[model samples]
Target: MAVPAGVAAVVREMQDRLDAMPGDSPLRDFLSTYQRTTTAVGQAITDGVFADGEWVEEWDVVFAQLYVRAYDAHIDGGHVPRPWRIAFDAPADLPSLRKVLLGINAHVNYDLPQALLGVISDADFADPVLLGKRKRDHEAIDGVLASRVAAEDDELTATGGKSLVDRVLQPLNRVSSKRFLREARQKVWHNTHELQVARLAGPAPYDVRLGELELLSAAKVADLLAPGQVLLRLAVAGFGVVLPPAA
Candidate 1:
């Protein structure tokens, strides 16, 4: 019921499961990217990059378990969140980038707030010393994630395989070209703060708002992957090839 072995072990388990999946399985590409990204962040935690490394290691395990549980449930014909439902049911031909994005979308938009609440529910947010450390450590993850994404550019492009579109967009690897990774994480922190406030006000209202957030985020993912959004999707993909930010 728990990922007691921690983030590194959880990532290894995911990689092993991914390896055993059918070669053409739609889930493989996304899981591959996820595993790589997670491993990079896990290394940062292992290196004591965060102010409260133990807190981060524990939080990472808890967060990963959500995805692990959802994956198992989907495999066993149990219910999962709408975003995950879309991901698990994806057609084999869905683009590699889309698969990666869909997984990110589901985890950050739907699962992150809840995970944050679990990890920090008892925190005294009004205490500047305690709150500041939490915030510092939270933001520290962004740089770790950004660097990891950049380092994996070649692997990510290779995962796209030999499609003309993939080749054409090869130069535009988003991981290198844009600040999307950092911004997405920042938004997750913002959302988690909002959720914590709502939950503090009242559990009933918080439950209602959580449902609303889930539906809204799921709808966004659905729209992003919709067949009618090809041109828009392409434009989004094109952003990856745009120039990297200046140092």
Candidate 2:
């Protein structure tokens, strides 16, 4: 499939997948939530929510294409990144929340840095004024995501039937979601710089660093599959994976 041209195209692509997926398909867990989030972000852009709406729109499109490519690759029996492979290969019986978290872990932790690199050139990184503007716009996304937590929780509960424990923990989950997203994005900015430096060095160095990110992201996703409260485990262990020092 052609890469989505804008946020609206991205939402439509996701919605098409959702419509095609069976109710019990594990992939639906993430796609449905992601579709909703993308719609919200699109609306925010239309509402002039960011200082640089055009930049945010470009970044959003680039960010989403990574996930879309991975999903398409998996479906086409092609090479899938280790992080996404873990998320996609997860058993169907896994909780919807866990499945969604798996997708989030893979996409946010693994795909985000590369996406940042896609939009922010090395020269842009060197310009403090430009970089600050980019960073501010990046953080603006946190507000959009934060606002969706309670509603997303309700959607998840409505579709999958949350346990009583989960129902009681709704407020905590909302707070934790916001916190982790912010933390993850912060790391994404740092990791993007690391990747940018590697890119400046050469394609070989960039590839090696990206491979390391893929491994670390996959490991984090695997950890989430283990027994424990997902949010609490994320809180204790922290969200987003870090890049190893440049070789």
TM-score of each: 0.83, 0.95
Candidate 1: tens digits of C-alpha lDDT, residues 41-157? 778877778998777877787788788888888889998988788877877687776677677778777787677777885555667798778878878887877676545556756
Summarize candidate 2's per-residue lDDT along 181-226 as a digit string, tens digits: 8899999888998899899999999999999999999999999899
- What's the C-alpha lDDT at position 149 in model 1? 57
Output the number of the lDDT-best candidate.
2
lDDT of 2 at 172: 86
Reference-based lDDT, residue 170, model 2: 81
